[model samples]
Target chain A: MKERIKVALAQISCKQGDKAENIRKIEDNVIKAKQQGAELIIFPEFSLTGYTVRDCVYELAETIPGHSTTVLEKLAKKTGTYIVFGMPELSEKTQATIYNAAVLVGPDGFVGKYRKMYLPTHSVFEEKRYFRPGCKAGVFDTKLGKIGLIICYDIFFPEVSRLTRLKGAQLIVCISASPATRRTFFETLTAARAIENTAFLAYVNLVGIEDGLQFWGGSRLIAPNGKVLVKAKYDEEDLVIGEINYADIRPIEAFVPTLKDLRPELFDELREAAERL
Target chain B: MKLKPSVLDLKWTEVETKIRRFIKDYVEKSEAKGIVLGLSGGIDSCTVASLAALAIGGDKTLGLLLPEQETFTTKDVEHAELAAEKFGFKTEMIDITPTLKAFYDSTPIFKTTDKLCKGNIKARTRMIYVYYYANRLGMLVCGASDKSETMIGYFTKWGDVAADISPIMDLYKTQVRKLAQHIGLPKEIVTKQASPALWPGQLAEEELGIKYETLDLILYGLERFMKTEEIAQQLGAKKELINKIKLRWVSMEHKRRMPLTTKMQYRTVGADFRLPRTLH
Candidate 1:
């Protein structure tokens, strides 16, 4: 018997540098999604800290199991829905360095944490200055299904998604604060990742203009076949939900045979070259 | 000519039309032909080309497609051609690979495989080509960069960044798409992925590591909503994405403004460069 999971993609507009308001907004959405019978509710990237609050990094960054995560833990327990969200998590031992982390809070407690693997340093992104990139890819086993969470920039690279899929992730969730100018590309890339990996993808993006830039929210859910089951409105805030029949994924995978066609030898060669560099 | 007082209260569309008309009249009064823009086949260039074609007839507007060895796909070239065809302009393609190679071969700094340096050189090389053509053709160099790209210093310093006039500098990428569609751009040109074509298989998103969609969202969240960490939590976006965006805002602070001055005196440039010019 295949498990059926209901997922919700929250396309919310984040206020820049305002922690209190953002938390209130998330709590409200979590309750709303749970009430709608969603098993898993995902938010956009960096939901706690607004995307462009450059000067507020040290001010807003908190330790996991600290204020923000503790609140999320309580919310998950109350809602009985798994919550996956992004935050600037400060390491316990290394207080000076910060990690761009995604927290998974289940009904019991904090279930898992996945730090961003790819730290973009060039052109409108200078992550090397602020973040220490995570070294490993993570997939958490949940009652809903095997879930994988990758941050915004991590989705651009195939290996991150591939690695998570290899770890047996049936559903891959991406939280994004993608802007309007790059919405078209994001949509294309997200769909591609889902199709190639043979996994259900739920993508949530931040909407509205922050600072001087604009975000075009086209949050969407893609089936394993690369078909968009549900897409959120761009440039507007909305709650998007979709039902996944895990039974259907196997047939699609059997027909397409993408996973069966293994080019590991070629990938290994490419990996070796990257390692040499 | 008398200026109407009621014009101040006009709707935004009316005001925009008036401003455009005023500029057009001024250009015509000066006896200048239509604007000349270098169409790089990227979003910025396409916007500039469309505007130039609209400002002046196709005959008056000139669109130049500059290509180098690093140009990943000919689709960019195709898009530029289609834009010119749709907008009614003269289109020309010039390969700058030889010129760039010549410069690289001569320079001692080319020993190392510094992709950044090489990329910058390509941009500069393209700029030189545009300026040269614009000069020979006696036309102004229209810039296609948007405020989003300019704000974070994503553009080349003196390369694709150089321009005599920029029409869309204040518009965000989202706004640019809206305007592009509003202007009746062909689907082929409008749907194309953006790239500088600096290197083979080079995509703007892949190179930046941060998708523009997310970058734009963060920028919008910070600038408009003023919701800091709360927004991040609400969206479930990675803190790293936020951090990266913030880092860009801080690091590229220099690119967003005029060159800094030592401020030795009270009347230095940038701080106080305002002086009434006396024309003889």
Candidate 2:
């Protein structure tokens, strides 16, 4: 039987340094996505804690199994839908170090967490000064499909999406807090990743300005074939839903066949060199 | 007292072209060979590389792709190579993994597997290398950062944002795309996502927790004279979302300007540096 899944990309705006308000906003979006018959819902990065907080890292950071996750866990159970969202996670052992983490919650319980791997230090981004990067690339199994979760900067690396695909992720969900100056880059990049990997890609971005950085919110869903199935309005908080048919993926892969013709040997050599160094 | 007219009212494209022309003229008059840039395979770098190639002949331009252990994919490298080939510029690839590892091992603070520290080290290291090659080759290092990044102070103080000359500094994110297509850049480079490839697996939007489209729309509205409520209404965005973006803009104001100085006297560096000094 061909499986079909309906996914919602909650491209919402968030307030900087307002954890309570951000959480409340996310909860509203989750309910809306669930009511729309979405089996899975994805929120922008740091949905609980707004991006670009000034020295509020310690104040806003929470633990993984802490209060924020508990709320999401309950929400997932209540909605009967899997939820993926971003937050600032304070390590249990070390209070000083924080991680920019993405947490997944299934209807049954918490599924998995993936921390942002890339911490940008350049213009308007000092993530390296705040959050720690994640080490592992993870894919979670869910009723919708094999799901891969990657935080914002992780999407820029094609290998991350490729590895998720190799781990049997049919759909890649990305949570982003990209600023407005780089909007076109985000839109084109997400579609390219989907086309190259032949996987369904859903990107949820924050809208509005945090601190002085402006966020250009253009949340969107791309099919395995790289066609934009649905795109959210720019600079707007929107609930974008798209239908994914597992059967359609095979046909798309058969037609394009970029993944089959990959030069793994060359990549292996590169990886080997990277690891050796 | 009312202030003089701000330069912010010009159309984005006109402003962008003026900036590009200014940089090009400065380089040409200086008798410099051409511009050299470090391509991270992100949108900013690609845009800058393309513009530099166009400003000067591809023969005089150079694009360097420096990859570390955590660089996500070879696609960016491929894109840079393809761009160089299409534009007729010299291209080089240098791996900084050994240098990064050696430095990390030598520094006690980086011994722990803290991703943030490691990522920053990589960024700073890459910047050092870019300058090393730029100085040796006698070419100006062209910066690819845009206004949004500049406004939010998202860039490293002297790392990725450092440059001898910046061509696209004034354009916003959306404006850059228009310019990229306007200048006949290939779809591959034009369409790629904006990323810093600091780690093996990373995406800019996913990491930042917001999408660029919405952010840009809000920014355009906000910067171009729309009120917060009006912006929300026009874009169909939620009021809360607009408020969030506005707050971010206000908070990150520090990143856009020079470091604050204690105004013990009436004049400070930023306040007093206004007069243009020229050697007679």
Candidate 3:
């Protein structure tokens, strides 16, 4: 039998700017994921404070060891499972700046945090106005495996996942608060990222209607070979679990050889020419 | 098999709340007093009227009965009145026969007396009244076109489809009917046959030669990328019927899209130059 790790993708609706209520729901899901024997549980972007917070994001931003994590750390300790969720972070270094950030916690408490790099400014997204983009891609070492964290819009760029994979991340988790519109794009893009990186991908999305926008919840898990192992139904909150086999990564990369074939020198040349233009 | 498909299942309460909030938000943001809709006494119009009433209260909602003298039925007018009474919305009746005659007598092109041409005029004439009242009352014109009719180009270009916003455009005709009943509309209006009421006894199913139920199923199948044969099997309908619906859906695709623009520059109006009206 292959070495399997159980992961839970919790697709739940978050109330905008209601930190206390959202935290209660998150704590409940932590207990639920643990009951199902999930070693790792993930949530959609801004799961602590709903997406579309807009101007209220400044008011909702919290420090990592602030009120939210203090409560979540206790839940992680009680459940004995790793909890990964999205929230707006009040920067410790820069008091005035806020970043759209994801935090990771485990039984021991306070694993790591990754701020989102890409702030979408077009269409329905006005994220750039509120979020100051993070400087680095983040990978955290956990008991289940080495995990990479990226927020919703970061997945649109292939470099984020590629860099995380090169850093020896066996599992990549993307937390998204994507809307119903352009849902097919998210589905296709996530699967492609999993295949190209040869890493197990877990995606969690929020659901519910707010401010005239509907967030479609089709949270899913993709295997290293690019097959969708499990997918939650759209427009509903669901807790879906899938087993990720870490052993499958090596065999898949050996066959496809995407990472093995080095093209960094060619990419640098293309980058230099584009810079001249 | 499963007699009732789960595809049509909807959380009507959640849907209603979302739409009500949508209407309320749009009206408040646009700074309009209310919304105005033409009530043909058909299921579509009735549903729109009810939703508008629920959103902004019946006192703010306006329903107009713009009936042509020859083609329009008195029963539809009666049904419209009943809906108004049930929803407590204000109503007005405008006989548009004189307006139609005024335009017809002026144009030599109208001498041939084509039904399609006359129908288009009637529809457009009603829109003129709808917008006139909407402007005078500082309200937005609500459209009654649903996804089923919208998919097959069943509406006139700038006539029946003319509106500031559509509350029910995403719902199919079958789903609209379900919503009608869910909203506690009178049984007579809920079960009434759908028609544009362009002419007397102009049944929609009769003109299309396909029932709304089957049409909705075919559309659902097509949207899901099912083959014609597979849809025929699933709906227990003929493959020719499925193919005809598919062809109509494909051919009428142009009607649902903006008018074609020849690329004159790096970006066109609705092509690469993309920004929602909200940004400006």
Best by DockQ: 3
Estimate the TM-score for candidate 3.
0.61
Q: Candidate 3 on B99-133: residue-level lDDT in tens?
A: 98899899887953577777888899999999999
lDDT of 1 at B197: 68
Which segments of candidate 2 are over 4 A away from where they belong?
A: A272-277, B1-280
Taking all chains together, each candidate's TM-score versus the true structure is 0.55, 0.53, 0.61
Number of colliding residue pairs in each model: 48, 67, 0
Q: Could you tell me the TM-score of chain B in model 1?
A: 0.83
Chain A TM-score, each candidate: 0.95, 0.94, 0.96
Residue-level lDDT tens digits of model 1 in A1-277: 1299888888887766677888899999988888888888888888887776653676778988789888889989988889998888888998668888888998888989888999878656666677899988779988888899898889899899999998888888888877655766888899999989899888888876554345677888899999999888877789988888887789888988778885888988898999999
Q: A1-277, model 3: which lDDT tens digit per residue?
A: 2268899999998776788888989888878878898888898999998887765666779888788988888888888888999999998887658998989998899999999999999887888777799978789888878899988888999989988888878889999989877688999999999999999999899987555677888999999899999998787789988899899888999999899895998888877998999
Q: What DockQ, on C-alphas, does every prediction get? A: 0.01, 0.01, 0.07
Docking class of 2: incorrect
Residue A145 local lDDT, model 2: 78
Candidate 1: which stretches are off by over 4 Å?
Answer: A275-277, B1-168, B171-280
Which pairs of residues clash in candidate 3, taking residues 3 or more apart in a chain or in different chains?
A: none
Candidate 3's C-alpha runs over 4 A off are A1-149, A153-175, A180-212, A216-277, B1-6
